[model samples]
Target: MEKLLEILNDIQPDADYETCTTLIDDEVLDSFAILSIVGELEEAFDIEITPVDIVPENFNSAQALWDMVQRLQEA
Candidate 1:
């Protein structure tokens, strides 16, 4: 989770990722930011983020993203 926070912070340091749940819905993470995050998450977690997994619900919060990563890793 700390690693995830680091990756997220590197992408957008201003936003409070720990508490923000409406990241994509609120436009806190725009397309460009999402692109950055996807790249970072893939590289950091050594997991491939399939197109099917790139949805707002999976990316709306840090916990959601972490859960997705864990699922991908287990798979």
Candidate 2:
């Protein structure tokens, strides 16, 4: 989770990823940022993020992203 936070912070240092749940809804993360995060997550976690996993639900908050990563790792 800390590593996920690091990734989020590196990509966008303005928002509080720890508590923010409307990252996508609030436009804190645009398309470019989302793509950057996807690439970073893929390389860091050694997991593939398919098009199906690119929904706003999975990218909304830090916890959601972590949950998705764990789920993919298990798969």
Candidate 3:
């Protein structure tokens, strides 16, 4: 989870999960940020993020993103 948190922190250092969740829920994440996160996750974890996996809930928080990465790697 530390790695996930680190990745998220690199993206938005001042953000907490609560803030990130709200940003996702409110459609405040621009396309560039979303793509940047996707790229970072793929490179960091060596996991493929398909279109089907690109859900707001999945990227809403560091924990949620970690769970998704674990699930994907497990699969």
Q: What is the C-alpha RMSD of each candidate to the true structure, in Å?
A: 0.6, 0.5, 1.9
lDDT of 3 by residue, 1-75 (tens): 777777767876667754365657765566777788889989999999999998888877667788899998998
Per-residue lDDT tens digits of candidate 2, residues 1-51? 999999999999999998999899999999999999999999999999999
- Candidate 2 Cα errors over 4 Å, as ranges: none
Q: Pick the candidate with the highest TM-score.
A: 2
TM-score of each model, paired residue for residue:
0.96, 0.98, 0.82
Q: In order, how many clashes per candidate?
A: 0, 0, 0
Q: For candidate 3, give the lDDT.
A: 0.78
Worst 10-residue lDDT window for candidate 2 reads 14-23
How much is the lDDT of residue 6 in candidate 3?
79
Candidate 3 colliding pairs, count:
0
State which candidate, 2 or 3, has the greater lDDT. Answer: 2
Residue 53, model 3: lDDT of: 94
For model 3, name the residue pairs that clash: none
- Which run of 10 residues does model 1 get worst, by summed lDDT? 9-18
Ranked by lDDT from best down, the candidates are 2, 1, 3
Global lDDT scores for all candidate models: 0.93, 0.96, 0.78
Candidate number that wins on lDDT, 1 or 3: 1
